[model samples]
Target: MSTINTSKRTIGVSFDESGRAHVLLWAPDAKQVELLLSGQDKTVSLTRGESGYWSVETRALQPGDLYYFELDGKKQLPDPASLSQPDDVHGASQALDINRFRWTDENWRHFPLKNYIIYEMHIGTFTPEGTFAAAEKKLDYLVDLGITAVEIMPVAQFPGGRNWGYDGVFPFCVQHSYGGAQGLQSFVNASHAKGLAVVLDVVFNHVGPEGNHLQEFGPYFTEKYHTPWGNAINFDDAWCDGVRRFFVENALMWFRDFHIDALRMDAVHAIKDFSPTHILGEIRQEVDLLIQQTGRKHYLIVELDLNDTRFINPVNKAGYGMDAQWIDEFHHALRVTSGQEKTGYYSDFNAVESLAKSYQDAYVYDGAFSEHRKKYFGMKTENPGEQFVVFSQNHDHVGNRMLGERTSQLVSFEMLKLLAGAVLVSPYLPMLFMGEEYGEKNPFQYFVSHIDPELAEAVRKGRKKEFEAFYMDGEAPDPLAEDTFERSKLQWGLIDQEPHKTLLQFYKELIAIRKMQQPLCVLNRREVSVEHNTEARVIVLRRQHKLQDVICLMNFSKEEQSVDVPVYASHWCKLLGSSDLRWNGLQDIPALVPGELALALPPESITLYSNKHE
Candidate 1:
């Protein structure tokens, strides 16, 4: 064995200028490394270099070549950094040439946070075919719906054909069932051509339980800290530098190789790293450097439960300096207020007051004691910082329920319109779940396809116990059932129906209003205020920007209520009303007269008024 440079490409197969593949593996514990070629008995020996890295170069290897690594002359496994897995997670790794695909998005410019209206989608359920190619057909529909960016759920390779994607084992490989790497590249290219940015969701907390081969390659996990999935990923212990580099490189690969504009990190709170510099901070710093080198805008968003401002606070201010984070306070408050089951986390929210606080501040329980957790939670913050991503419904919020019921099933159409107004017109970045704009009746259920029979049985039992607290009506659906996954697929034809079409039109109108009205689009926290009447169950949100002012009045009660306006207006014009007869409402609402303190609000209706003479 000869000592070689450790800084060289010592992970997955990398291609040189001549198109020859350079294969490398990190196996300090193995004394012998052999590359097993597909459909051949011959094996190539790899030389061990410094830092236990084994390296070998050959022209015989090319894109789409299937191969595996044999450790100590036995125990063959897929490459830890495999870029494409044509077979399932248990099959061999296939080399993919990312440069082969020609891209026409070189002139596409990345937009900033102020221009973002994110639409979250799961590719498997977004269309009937459940493939990236199938999803490419919907790009025009999303663009027409006012979505500037599409936040895709995790596409990392998992065990079988169906999964929610959080339980992925191969962080580098795109799911083979979703058209593999080539399909993903085509999808991204199609999106950019249609003027839509792609935001990919990635998980670094813990690897999936099935087909996780990283442990055999290196110490990628540790018992020092435990996560809900299993042992936490090693990020701060001995030889943890490789572990950190692996994940950070994965994020960069999405931006540099896959042409992803942003990454929405899943469950950052579960990533327990007590190092001097957190992994999130390191990822952000590396992404920043990539932005400068490529001259393209990139963003790092996180899904955190801590509600800590440090996630978005600048690093100079002793924070992680993330671009944005998904805040669930607004969702929870809206869910509870709109008459969803309020037994679990909903107990912390009192609806009207909590919604008011959510509009005024990003977090309702910032530094406040929680009865649910029985301890002080969250950091205090004054403004939303335009770094909070607000949504009425998403994958977790809908699929995690006992029955996987959507907000449309849980609340009336009027309440749904009200919730849409609250999220879309807010100062923070707004996101919509798949089919939400059309009021799709199909539920987004929790489904999985695990190969292990024993593990599959255990998953079914665990799901039943988890939803017991909610006291749901029907029996919980078996997660391993194929019918469960099929039922969760979005019904695309629903948009042509009567009520669904009307609701879809209403959503389009609301988005148009948000974009056309300058006061509604301004993200300044100082210009926004919320006032509500507890007894009448009506709330008024005021937004003022220089000479322009807008007010959104919402009635949560079942019966009509008279709301008082404290701020006098010289002239007011009705921009939109959810209960208007145009939107399938029974009553016709008239514009408010000037100097009128008492305004009649229809039951469960939301009305927006623009005061030009304020």
Candidate 2:
């Protein structure tokens, strides 16, 4: 519904059923173009069109007016397809009427991406009046902690008002301190009236050098590929089809104007593009024609450190269709089996059988050999497990740590409930960052304000030279400090104390035993299976699904092993344990009898079990 294209070779602020205000701009190296138009003092000129787009219709403009763009009338800027900058990001660009907000989520719908649980917040520290109407007053505490979708993170319009939004630069405005663009269309209509689903997190691979005006609206960037947040977003240049239709119309203006149901994308292997289709397969064939003209459901989910399954494969096989991704090898084999440090790329995840090969393959370097980017990595795809999106405290594994601690400050709340039972009984698609369910002891650091004092001391000497090889306590928090974004917010009064209310009731009893377990809500990776002991550090998995099967066991050791598992057929039962004195643990190992193979395991725990049918 919102690939916003006003019949006049559209580019930015549209309007027309004779209500006027056209305004386009692409700027083929701007020879002239004007608009200024706020409270008008005359300046309207545009007409260049013919493939360099320039437009300008006016009835003195309409929808929320306020404008910019002058170029060659002495360079002004700020409208590389802006929908609303509401003054900042170097000011003016606000004619936002992509059908002005009013969307009571037309019966919202969009679920699948393995029926998401994703939480991943950061609308400025998830709250402390961090706007988007204070994170929609915590969406009923993330739908009472069973969160279905939230994602967020990048909100575009970055620069000042403290960021972490990967320094966004008006990729269709929004973040005028988080409550703009109709406060993200009323936080996606209150997350679709509480059923959830929002996603977002964009950052189209490079465009944040403070208020960057997309190269004055022309060759949209590219000095011949190079990214690390610099250039490389020309996506195959020479007026790259109006910069790939202005980022596939800003990812279909957040699923046709802010009804957003998915878009993670950030860092698609730094989106270089050699053309021949692949602007992420032309944004998945234009969001599959906007989900066949808005029957809803959108999704995209990328974020690649190149374990490439051709970006979630299948677009007639040549790949890049994308529906899911973000598989950091099961959070680097569960943080090197919960004992952390293996150094960069965690030295190819020092085995715990790489967490049973990322639970029977979702990619643990499918191509192998990568002692931290030394070569031969990933590319073996049979993509499943909800096309991969696993997590264990994200925001770049806890704000690219150094001091932004948290895996509950580096392990042990019984290995953070054994890494939340290996990410909610893995079959993929699980995510939780914002205060990780209920253990939020702050520290999601890496804040920013960047009113560029030499880009704020090169982002505080590049985050203390990228965390000077770990071990940080005292000084590293000034990410241009606002008390490091108020010590990275989320201390919602420590969720009623005591192991954060017993890890928020063990993450709401493992998301209510993953929705009353049917092999943990089916995403069928051929009914999964793992089984590893790695010298009694223990691992187990097994799922199944149709008539149920389960089994799960975890224990990444702190000494409490027993092992002998696998025998998922006859009588099992004990569903959900994370070491159980009602989750404050100490032991509660029940049900299991298949030639009674001793199983115990309580130190760093996780249990599960099931059985049924036949």
- Point out where model 1 deviates above 4 Å: 1-10, 382-385, 468-472
- What is the Cα-based lDDT of residue 162 in candidate 1? 90
Top-TM-score structure, candidate number: 1
* Deviation from native of the Cα of residue 276 in model 1, angstroms: 1.3
Query: TM per model?
Result: 0.96, 0.37
Q: Considering summed lDDT, which 10 consecutive residues are worst modelled in model 2?
A: 1-10
lDDT of 2: 0.80
**For each candidate, what is the lDDT?**
0.86, 0.80
Q: Model 1: per-residue lDDT, tens digit, 1-614?
A: 11222223335887877998888777767899988877766678889987767899987777888988899877999988888877788788987777677888999999887778999999998998999999999999988888899999999999899999998999988999999888999999999999999999999998998889999988889989999889999999877877887888788888887899989999999998889889898887777777777898888899988878888887888888898999988899888777676877889998789888888888989888999989988877764546889999999989988889898998888888888998888888999999899888888999999998888889999998987765648778889998999999999889999799999888889888888888777788888889988777788988888887788889988889987777777767888989989998867767755764467899999988887642
Residue 208, candidate 1: how far off, in angstroms?
A: 0.9
lDDT score at residue 586, model 2, on the 0-100 scale: 89
lDDT of 2 at 180: 80
Residue range 29-142, candidate 2, lDDT tens digits: 778888887667767888897778888677877887787878888977768778677667888787866665577767777777787988888887788988999889789988
